[model samples]
Target chain A: MTAAAPPLLTVEHLTMRFGGLVAINDLSFTARQRQITAIIGPNGAGKTTVFNCLTGFYKPSVGRLTLTPPNNGGCFLLERMEGFRIAKDAGVARTFQNIRLFAGMSVLENLVVAQHNRLMRASAYSVAGLLGLNRYTRAERQAVELARYWLDRIELTGQADWAAGNLPYGSQRRLEIARAMCTEPCLLCLDEPAAGLNPRESAQLNELLLDIRGQHGIGLLLIEHDMSVVMQISDHVVVLDHGAPIAEGTPDMVSNDPAVIRAYLGAAEGEALPPDVAGGLPTAPPC
Target chain B: MLKDALAAAVVAALLALPLLGFRLADSQQGLSLDYRFAWVGYAAAAVFIGRLGMAFAAAAFSRVFQRKRQTLLPLAGRPSRNRKIVGWLLVAAALLLPLAPFADRNLIDKATLLLIYVMLGWGLNIVVGLAGLLDLGYVAFYAVGAYSYALLSQTFGLSFWLCLPFAGALAACFGILLGFPVLRLRGDYLAIVTLGFGEIVRVVLLNWESLTNGPNGISGIQRPSFFGLPFLAAAPGRTTFHEFFGLPFSPGQRIIFLYYVILVLALATNLFTLRIRRLPIGRAWEALREDETACRSLGINPTRTKLSAFALGAMFAGFAGSFFATRQGFISPESFTFIESAIILAIVVLGGMGSQIGIVLAAILLVGLPEWFRDLQQYRMLAFGGAMVLIMLWRPRGLLASREPTIRLAADALEAAPQTAGEAAR
Candidate 1:
């Protein structure tokens, strides 16, 4: 336990069951501010199920998922909250593995909508906004200013008015992240954000994620299938196979762990790790 | 071409043989079979000719418009630049319609009826179009509004103006009532529940005779006045609208006044919807429509957002219903049926989900033209359904279904973007 850093989110004894199957079992991890924690695994490893439980999308059969924002902001038991309350009150936001932008709305509008809770207050639940009050205008301008800042971060300012769905796939992925950040979350969870990206796009995603952690000073929880991304940027790593953790440590430690290597390679016990496997488990994506 | 046409003719002849070729005729002794093979031959020839014509038309159309289609198809999802002019033209037409030489009281009255539907379509546009909730029982709120106004006005001798807001509020309350049970439902399930809700309201109105006067419906509903001045002729020292204006009182005055009133109300509905789309709640509704899951993750409370949409949408329906009651001076369960809901929804869908301008055109096409063909009686519905089918084939997204951004940043803001020059390198 490092007393130097304060934990932002802590998941303990997390277990999820779907009828006869346990999708996740006994998952424990702590994510601190300004850190990126990545969960990597083989297929059906309950990586996304962890995300579901933390974001309140699914109720874990047994677990305690807690989020505590910095500076005594609030302590929220996420598993007890509704999905929106987790985002609105607990300040935890997520992007889907399959990109889910408001495809028909403009990119800027997509970001603006993520700030709905803040503006809803300024608008007094829409009555003041409907009446064209000056307060609402000021609030809306600030929302736009924040949205413009994210657009610049992702280099999407030029295409802010383009319909979100009309953007290229890489742009859509970045836009989804920007939209998630627009909610000003204490912890941002990204689910396979680089799933289909080419090597260059993946590199750009690494840059953006690093910038977000360093500049915004927020904790990030990542579920990544791409070994290159998990290895290069993640501060700490957790590996799971068949709903149970096999290894957990720094990326370097996890990559060299015999159990993680065996889980990735499905090899016989004591088998030698490949030259590349020692750097990134399974050496996937050729990056 | 000839070979394909021959095949079509053969298929048509086989299908028509049983229906057209032979008939059972009652003869003196017993039922006898009578053959009319010539009728089958006629059917085959008709099919043959139709197939040939269609083939020729297809060839000609493709040859003439293939290049145009390529240029146009990519831009189909965007709102056209000239839509502003088209919108202005529509506005002008609506304003000038009652005063046109050809627009007598009969014509103006029909136009007024059409505007009522136009208003209803706009109201449903919020729920079904922007919010993406498939409401099939929207008319229940319409019925609620109508009944609320009828009962209040009769029981307490309330004026139409005094009861309008109450009718809208009452209907909105009912909307929230329906909204709560179905917040978790979507697509077909939501639709089924709403459809059932519509029927339930109609049935309640039908059987609750003591309160609703049963199937006989409430009658002698008060007509709306211009503020406090009724449209009726002057009595004693009190003056009607025309009498106050020192103009001749034609019976047409009342019709024209009603037309303007609905026109103003419809415009108010349009203006409010247009303004709200730029607000947080409206944007939230659109976002909710686009992706409900994404909405949840973005801190939008799905239930509250959906309920607000339902209540606001029903409020508009209630307003339209009150106007409907006043215009007809009668109300009943028969007025608010599943078909009425279907027609209002059709106007929203056919107008291209969220397009305000499209709703106006759809209302005119779906409601106005059908009235013009009222002479067809039962066949009018057949024509309406056929026209809708043809329209779906032509523009599956609804005519003018431009999925345009509800709001665009000003040009100067685009200019202020620092990456505009850097984008080329990217």
Candidate 2:
């Protein structure tokens, strides 16, 4: 939470390819702890590919990703972990661009199952103990408590028993996020969390992002197409174009940068954002 | 109402068919009713009544309560102690029917055949239904099991009971072997591989004459006798089952005993499958079926989950296959063919995949109806296939599709549930 603390996630010259296509080319950036970092780009600019690499969905062709901590000592390389292992061992969890909530399952079951890894661990120990092979049901109680805590945090108390697929689209989207959060992630990567939102919903999403960062001290890596959301809520911005990073800076600095503007808003209106929003952006932000 | 009345009338006619030979015949023209046809008729009527009753009950109850009607059915409501009792009663009736005094000999035998197919349908349901993996070579495992029991029992003088477990084990081992190499294939490719695998088993059985007796098949196969007591042969001093009970010996007793054995086996298949569905591995199968990517993200090994589905499905086929050999006292390659697997798959599809009761109803309809229509034998399969297509069109998801999740949290866990857009952002 302090300036002296290292950034939570540091990416250096990450590159990826699909046969002849260079999907992510030399993308480098850092996601600092306790801040919402937005990665925005035109379609096919590899914003999602970068997210995929960070979450172990894709193996980068080149470069390293190191995540530090707000309260811990050393940084760890994220690229080495498998997708599920990354979530388990490194406390990294993510939501998809298209909602991946299990449709036949209930809303509550979706979240509870997110804590499946932990519950399984507990059950194994208890079974062994019952057979006079080992001891301790502490893990079981802890898993239930953790599941309960997140259920309260997400505010989905009323519709818990409803099948996830039956929930309204907006609610399904929220449940997906809450399911990811139930894993108690240190770094949460959300893919286009505000893509289909109305103005009011977008505003609400901004507040949630702030709350998530402030209260949990979790680093947020968000890939978004909504410029309003990216400009309003992101503490740091990394802009990509044609599978490469074009700009990285504080929100205001990146907003005013010609390359960021050209990549996102087109060359003509690159610098046309209202003055107040530009003035609020951080200057010379440390990584 | 008219349809119900007509259906009931048909049921009454079918029930009277077994006694038709005794009562309806006169001492002149010489026409008689077959007992097997009567059994088929009874089974068809049971299916029709059970289905219609469930549908009407569901609609009526839901209308009165203003809730989802589907919940009235078993496995839809919260797990109850009553379900266990109901399950046991159904099992008992299925076993005890053959023991009843008026049950026909040929009728019981036909019913046992129907139960064996039901077991096959249920087993195939695991692979195609639970795991969403299509397998068209299921009967290959049936052949492996049948041949294993026939070869081992005939060559070594092994008891049918002892050979039963060995057959299942051998079939399961082969199943696991099949599972290993083809674990990664999906959709059409997987189906092709399974189809080829089934044909391969049949070809092997046909070519391996020294062991399987080639095209002639292994005959003189032993029928399983209960508690080491053979059914009476009707010669002097041979203890007939009826004589043991101080009654007249009748062919019905032998048919009834085989009926009970198969009925027990079929019920065991159902119970074992239900228990496995509630286990961790079962959930994993469901999860993988829904989304493989999500399953992998949840730390499940897709290879292992898929393999388990294959092995378990094959094991059931083995059980059913060995039972067939014992019941018929004969074996042949022609029985374990691709058409057999297709029929099993059709039953699973028509029945709601993953639904135990649905499969039972579907099996009776698919297998029993045809035999009942044996007088119109050439047209029966055509009608059968048409019925399957119509049923599928009517219920694209299956007859009793799963509308609810198996694992879930209690009602109070939703205190923090996300509401309108305003709350989600914060």
Candidate 3:
């Protein structure tokens, strides 16, 4: 990636206020195309709020959220669109912090549902599909292929016929990512993809995220609490404290910054920093 | 178990205190209280024994059923091949019902009523089951369909065939109309709005005397004819169905014809629903049911998908309503009351939500069983209510709990590709 190439998404002065509280205030960042930009913060630092605004879940009080699609198709003003339009029209897909697979639906059906808009067009408003037309059958075959491909990628092929809720926790998390990928999103926003996972599962998640970025060339905006995953995999890191960015740079630069440590420790501004605490900031944050 | 029996005896004694101790009788002169000590004691004993028996049976049943599986397991794996066989058997039985040698007018009539409920259950299933929209006012569409047919036929002298589609269209229009305001609602709020909508339609029909004939309702609505021939006595100028068919005109013939008409209509509804369930929109419905936020994230427009469910469900209800009006030769607001909506909703829930075949079995059990026990008179509803409670207790997920996936990676897809001629030679 070159500096001259434009970023895929740009959030300029994004501010979201809920009543008297400012959840995300004056945030600006750029997620380069095919790059993993990690948003790491202490609890209640409004990391998820930034993802919400970019994905059109919440309208920012004052900001411009722009998404530049591949091939320069058009720049989508994400905040101006509805949540679903941001997904359907702007080609943005997301997974929730708490896993939100269609619990009663099968794993295969979950992936197929992610391709709903495309399959719907092939079905010609379902008339063709209902009539068992060739176009629908072809599209359907392709959909099943896509579902199977992802199933194998997630290593859940054996559980394809099982209800999504019946899968193990780690597999459900992978299934959610696979489901998001099936939407063919230009930008994937994941909220805490590594939550509630063992060390090995986190390592697998890192590999999966790296593979997604490598193969799909889709930009990823991640909100993660795990410092190891963020420090290991992130190309760019943005640190937020009290709804505003406190630090931004490569993971190495941001992790070593004193302000990032102080924010994480919840210390008051200008408070005397402990010598050992300041000195002990690891150059390489341990996983 | 003995403790439970003792508790039940105390509760029974409390219950028997008022009704068993004294009964209000309308004597020739005035109302009087009559003592029935022995009868009260007997009733109390019966209640005590019944409660004890039920508790013991339930304990024994759970002990047997739960011994192998202590944890609640997901019941929705791939439906077994056996289920497919059972489904085919059910369809065959329904098809052969009218042709059975022992079929009588009353039995056929009951079957027709049962099929009507089955149709209504399937219609409600789309909204409440597939789309996960709790539409309590489903009967409003039924009312709209019935009135559309009744008014069209009476005013314009339109035949049943013409009115049928008109009725369905009008009902669909109402469905969309009702769907708009509740687009953002879900669960209980949606249920409330739908219930209100159902009541509003009934009240409008009742108050609008000129249009719906008010409480008197529209009557003498013509029965559906076989093409241009009426199902009546052959006369000098009229061409009757029996006369055209060269058969004796028994009254039972008309009942049997009506039964087949409803059978065809109900079967059509079933087929359309089953087919639609496999389509993209159908999948969208189930997705929306599971999680609306996820549906939006997947690029599915919830409004359009939900509206389609509402309109489609209402359209079938409208068709059934029109059939109801024609079959009974009457249309009234009373017929489309909240109880009717409840019964239809009950059928859908008791049938296991989106299960098509489950709806049929539920309708037979709920509608047909009650009618068969009509000899119970005042206790019929009591028995019906008790049966419902028992069923819900035994199977909270309804009788048929399996869910068949809409799509599969067929085993054949994994097999080797066809060998080319050169490859085969090699």
* Tens-digit lDDT string for candidate 1 (A56-92): 8898999898888996767989999999999999899
Q: After superposition, how far is residue B350 of candidate 3 from its true place, in Å?
A: 0.8
Error of 3 at B206 (Å): 1.1
For every model shown, what is its TM-score relative to the native structure? 0.92, 0.77, 0.92
Q: Model 3, range B1-426, lDDT digits (tens) per residue? A: 778777877787777878678989999989998888877678778877888888888777877767534223332233457767877898788888878998888899999999999999999999988998999999999999888988898899899889989999989999999999999998999999999999999999999997888999999998888888888886569889899989988888888888888888888888888888888899999999999988898889989999999999999999999999999998788899999999999998998888888888888889999999999999999999999998998778876655788876564442332223341232
Q: Would you give the TM-score of chain B in model 2? A: 0.75
- Model 2 off-target regions past 4 Å? A6-8, A32-35, A66-84, A88-91, A119-148, A207-217, A231-235, A267-287, B1-92, B155-158, B225-254, B411-426
Q: Rank by DockQ, highest first.
A: 1, 3, 2
Per-model lDDT? 0.88, 0.74, 0.86
Chain A only: TM-score of every candidate? 0.93, 0.85, 0.93
* Alpha-carbon deviation at B259 in model 3, angstroms: 1.1
Query: What DockQ score does model 1 reach against the true complex?
Result: 0.54
Write one digit per residue (lDDT tens) for candidate 3, span A197-246.
89999999999999999999999999987766887888999989989999
Q: Write the per-residue lDDT of candidate 2 for residues A130-201, one digit (tens) a residue.
A: 332322245534544665565555555555666676666666767778778777788998999886778776
After superposition, candidate 1 runs with Cα above 4 Å error: A1-3, A267-287, B1-81, B234-237, B376-379, B413-426
Candidate that would win on lDDT: 1
Looking at model 3, residue B370 earns an lDDT score of: 93
* Superior candidate under lDDT, 1 versus 3: 1
